[model samples]
Target: MGMFERTASVFDDAMVLDEEYQPDKIRERDEELEQYRQALQPIIDNRPLSNIFVYGKTGTGKTVATRYMIDHLQEDAEHYDDVALSITWVGCENLSSSYQVAVALVNELRSSDHQISTTGHSQQAVFNMLYTELDKIGGTVLIVLDEIDNIGSDDDILYGLPRARANGYIEDARPLVIGISNDFQFKENLSPKVRDTLCEAEILFPPYDATELNSILYPRAEKAFYDDVLADDVVPLCSAFAAQDTGSARQALRLLYLAGKRVADNGETNVTGDHVRGAKEELHQSKVIEGMQKLTTQGHAVLLTLASHTANSETPVRTRDLYDRYKTVTEKIDADTIVERRVRAHLSDLTMLGLVTVHERNEGLNAGRYHEYELSVQLDSVLEVLSEEQRFDDIVEIVKQQVHGMDRT
Candidate 1:
């Protein structure tokens, strides 16, 4: 066997150990981490904890930092009998109603080794069960609602629970809430009463700088990869790429892992600039398409048509024009759908998902600009995925016609 083959047989260390990396081991967010911990320290000490709203763009380590601090708080809570720390973490997206939330709480409480309940019960009954459980435990119970914005339709859980503890309904347990959200507009849209209670302490985690990201990457990389597998430049590249949206440590870590895998797959012992570049290209392509796929089927239809039309066109297409093309395609498919306004809704969704970008230009300073949509992902990459479907030819033809018409117009 060759020397490299011998090394591969011997060296089996991986750069990323698991899907969830530990926060204590996370580098370069010392200030951010310390500030976050300080905000929740009162709760840990059996003092009243404020309901903190953490906001940032996606992957800024907001969730990770919050989880880490809370975990520490849980440990610290054990020593203080005055501070009864019970943590129930709920993701708002999974359950839509207050009833669902109550059920989720009871289920989580029951499943926990803390072992709050085991019997079958109604949602309301489960909530009562939870309340009793909280009362039994006493002291401060921290309810962490991750992606709290997704609890939209029945936000009564959010609106009511804090007040329940505040108004002496539980009588024993003082509940502290930490709500985490990616949506910038979440606070503005919340009911005035909900905002009054939920906004007591708001901590915003901004994106990580290159320096901070390097701090985070070094330890994680060192733990996950062989010594000297990554160059000094790789962390900076990952940080710079992720910084614009949200200085996402998660994204940087993901990119690093993918880059390492790319090198390993290509039969290299070490990761290099070429592997990093290739990972970026592959990640961008996959991210756009996968993100698009995650959208509603209607949203996918909107994208398929928009991308196809753009590919066939000589120039970028406007929203109104795309609506016209979409109408024709929907009719051919015999689907009953909403009109242009709803199409604009799907357009906005697509824009947010980064499948397409919207450019606005105003004729004069006073006159407001109008938006024109353009594909952010490669048109062919999108089409290649769509082409696997049965109606690919028909979809292609419609787009081609629209393009030719735009040229003639």
Candidate 2:
């Protein structure tokens, strides 16, 4: 075969590892799908439909499962004249409020050439427009709002859609809402009225365990890679690492994809355990950077303190030490300084993000206990990611010099 004749010596189709690729079959989520089916059956029957609230951590098959079940539902509903199912799928991540969501929906349903501007209307007016558009669809409309927690505290869409028919806002359509959220506390933040309606049938999708992730990746490995492209134990190793990291099937697939790509690019015939190791580290660094991109000024500052210490020989650094370094960091960056107490809270947030590990130490019960924290990730990864933020560039440079100077000392 010519050197460049084939796109890959390994992958038959790499899309099987893609995040957007829907598997022909969903693995390890049979029970969750069954429960989702029960929650959805009423809509197929043209009965009063229950609004759904689904909660799960990232990459746990919540979105995929929802899409899979609804695909089957929509396909089945085609046979019935009474069941006119119109599915409106919205990702609420970028559309942060009820107003924005309503306008987006209105535009989605409107004639393409006649779409209205997204702003300049009152929230109620935008909602009225949404109701008008839904009435036009005139069916059992299942609105799947993924990342529904993006609305923060103002979940007017949830509160309004469930009651749209009864309140006479939407005359012809019976609207059912399916809200999928990754944020665990989002439902708790909803007002009781919104919560009761939106969470009428709640489904929680748990993270996948090691065995489950292995099961998920095995078939994809078969489809994506040529026969025997992956060396022995590579799939299991990917599964184990992902299970330990986040128990996310998506993460496992990504590791496989990255490793396969590495082997292909390097003209290697086999994807090995070493390739998986490198891929996992690359994925970890990317995830940490992505997570850091979401942090606030204070979050970045507190993390910098930990990274700065880790750059030096110090680790399992005390909270007081973190606060002290954080104070210096905030001053250098010209960012608004947060109090030590608030820095403690930011430390907790950083800990939750898995950027750092925390340990509680008791002062032998004679004095009050305090906490210690260390960077859970590599200091190099932290500095690289934070360097992307312009305000933090100066600080990262300072830390780079600090580490270099420490080395010389």
Off by over 4 Å in 1: 1-19, 43-45, 111-126, 166-168, 291-380, 388-409
Assess each prediction's global lDDT (C-alpha) against the native.
Answer: 0.72, 0.87
TM-score of 2: 0.81
Off by over 4 Å in 2: 1-7, 291-409
Taking all chains together, the TM-score of candidate 1 against the true structure is 0.74
Question: Residue 6: error of model 1 in Å?
Answer: 12
Which candidate wins on lDDT? 2
* Worst window of 10 by summed lDDT in candidate 2: 1-10
Clashes of 1: 7
Worst 10 residues of 1 by lDDT: 6-15
lDDT for model 2, please.
0.87
Q: For residues 26-114, what per-residue lDDT tens digits would candidate 1 score against the true structure?
A: 45557777777787888756566677888877777777777788888788878877666777888767665667777677666664565
